[model samples]
Target: MTDDIDPDEELMLAAEYALGLLAPEEAAAFEQLMARDADFREEYEAWAENLADLTDDIAPVTPPPALLNQIRAAAFGTAAVAAPQPEEVEPPATAPVFETATAQGRGLLQRLGLLPAVGGGLLAALVALWVIDATIGPSLALPTATATLVSEDESLVVEIAYTDDGEWLEFNRRTGRAPEGQDLQLWLINGDRAPISLGVLPAAQTGQLRVPEDYRQLLHGGNCAISVEPLGGSPTGAPTGEVVAIAPIVWET
Candidate 1:
């Protein structure tokens, strides 16, 4: 593809390359183009950064031995051989003087009747601290809300949750289908404020939307609406098409 590609197409290509969905030949061609075009390279790097951030929370895992061997064989034309086990070795014996000193120290504490008290106090303090921590510590939780948008005989379920990063909305269920050459757009309607566009819904029955931080507060006890708009989205910064569904956001306790 030429460097003067459409923005959406360029973004899609960058996403595909970052996700490793591109074929080897396509990846090679993309890499060549990226090397030649600074802007293309920047776009690809941005996609890579975003992909990395999205997956940063996932824990790393080691492959099973059988799977690893199969991968090795596929890549190198030979299965990986297991390394020989190392022989167990005995640890060095402790010096008698160190043991004697430790025993003397323990005997001195016990004779003074302080060892038991100290140990018990330390254990109790640790347990109390643990209890306090468990009871009062801030938990990693998000505030969530749900709403059901209904119009006539059709109904759709939507959920909103506030996270540290931003607010997210999930279309758990959608009943209406957008007409051909048109798309369904989700809008956030705060009390008397102008409707804020979330984004276009995918064709699937369920999808997610990220609400910008500035618009997150609007989702609390507000209303969510769906409207039919152009393929891309509403062009007039407002819904021009017919509103299909409207639901009140119910905050979760």
Candidate 2:
């Protein structure tokens, strides 16, 4: 609600509201905010319009009678009963002229391809582009690097990727678990350079390391290694246990 909120977070909140995913109390509060804030109202309207266009291509489906009856019974403690059909009524003779004019206008628009030009596909693409810009921003075009760390016998394998934020490592352990009393520590090693401790891997076998600016230069074209350490990690600055896996970092344009 404050102007200091992150723009991306604000946009996402607006999108969630437009999707009708907010609870009743939250929706009421958002509506009240929108009423007082013109910019917030505009953001909500844009999201609503884009979402409506994105889902417009989906066909409506009718639920089975049994399902409908069950829902009705749960809500009202009884199933709905059918009522007598209403008698058919005739329309005024002028209805044909209005119907013909409407058909003619639709035919003209079809001939001009205006209707198809505004179809769901284009709207979907626009929505995707908007989301990408909002979340990843323009920095998504930056280059990245990757590598695969493997043990001496090639039994243990871990995938590593480097981006602007930092390096990410993923292991494919059979159990994806660290030793009962030990932790797995990651290291970055360059020729003759002291092994730099990157951090310990999570029990889930996937973790990220934010390379400090001072150490970023040493990470490129370096060797990545993992070693088993004490529960809290290596007490000494250097690795004390045997190196488990090593891989060469490869940069990609």
Candidate 3:
């Protein structure tokens, strides 16, 4: 419905359909067309929002006939009596157009820091993070608290400090295990309160765990515990297998 569009193209389809200017046949064609085209769909998201938003701000004020006549004359030819065509704006520039189902696929790649390339070409994507970070300064450090780790049936306890950021823990692994898939996972328990995930562990003679930030709050409130978990970590966010070594991280200074 826009200028130079022939009252036919898909972009005009969305523009007119969005404005309630499309006939039933044209509206049906637009919906079916949207199912196959990603770029068109992206454009629709941008355009539809604008049309929908105007509903609340503007009221239904009927203008005088002279004003209405002038407006109609300006928009449509004098002989053509139909909805005035609204021009379309450029679509929102989003990541490559993929179905929402692909959102999870996109996230998986992002977790390993791989998504920047697919959206824009490699160089453009690589600069996105740097550009984004430039506008925002360094991450702020969280408040700190102290806790303790202790062994049962023995008196090996260590007091530790944790911050809202996270706690880094190191512990010894028994020597002499062949590489048959032995791995270490870390978990944080706040008494009856639900536990949150701290990531998987790296294997060395001694290993370090970055405990969750919430641990400080839990420990300060008197409910903190830790356990080594299965290789790929707990299947559920909550621990499932035996909790190996446990400690209450307590703050002192």
Candidate 4:
């Protein structure tokens, strides 16, 4: 392969293939070469193995006390304490109103408290590539990956997290929603693969959706998107309307 193709260009193609940055036709051509050429196959695998190592360096961030309390409340159905009467003194601001949640949801929140909007896009893309190329083990008990999908016009922002063990995904709509007559549908995109419907997002600010068994593995380095569709959802099986928001699914920790 290097004899006909420039060695530098060959390596670059291998890296791009490993990252899933190539278009469908391009990826298909590359895969054909890999099937016929042992050297090219080794080169692509090397890049894939190196990319998967990125997950090892991720570290979780600790949220502020108040924010932690809110996460706990959302994870569990813990109600906020009632306000003090006018005649009575209020409790200290730092005091906890609800017991800390030790459930799986809380575990996911702890790792996902401070994900940046810009960071991890590449990591997520590369991780998706790694997932496609490598054999990943079973899902973890708690998910640490998350994505914040924002529209180009900044009209919408949705936070997404997936729990492979539970086979469910949690979404928190921080801002924006469908127009009065429309509903927002969620789609999961993995590399050059076709987008899979996660279904219409709930109107509620926070909710969970059960994921099908096959689609669970695709969430790690995939992307979640929200598109404006008809009242119930897309009439077509696929997205026929404009995609309003999109973001890469990434590790929070």
- List runs of model 2 lying over 4 Å from the truth: 1-140, 165-176
Clashes of each: 0, 0, 8, 1
Ranking by TM-score: 4, 1, 2, 3
Highest TM-score scorer: 4
lDDT of 1: 0.53
- Distance (Å) between predicted and true CA of 177, model 4? 1.0
> Order the candidates by lDDT, highest first — what do you get?
4, 1, 2, 3
Candidate 1, which ten residues in sequence have the lowest lDDT sum?
100-109
TM-score of each: 0.41, 0.40, 0.31, 0.46
Q: What is candidate 2's lDDT per residue for 1-253, written digit by digit as tens?
A: 5768566765566677777665433443354355346677688779868887987898989765456544433333221334212232322233222211111111111222221122232234323422332232123354454555554344455666776445444344433345689987878765445678877776665556667677766655465667779986788967777666544454433
Give the residue spans of candidate 4 off by over 4 A.
Answer: 1-141
RMSD of each: 26.3, 25.1, 24.3, 14.1
**Local error of candidate 3 at 14, Å?**
67
- The models' CA-based lDDT, in order, is 0.53, 0.52, 0.41, 0.61
**What local lDDT score does residue 163 receive in model 1, on the 0 to 100 scale?**
42
Q: Cα RMSD for candidate 4? A: 14.1
- Backbone clashes counted, model 1: 0
lDDT of 4 at 27: 49
Candidate 3 lDDT, tens digit per residue, 1-253?
Answer: 3566365475776677666575432443344355346676567667778877878887888665455544443333232234333332332244222222111211111322321112122224224322332223223344344333332322223333455445564544433221245443444443334555555545555556665554534444332333445566667777554333333332222
Q: Compose the digit string of candidate 1's lDDT tens values, residues 28-109.
A: 3354355346677678679768877987899999765455444433333221234322231322233122211111111111
The best candidate by lDDT is 4
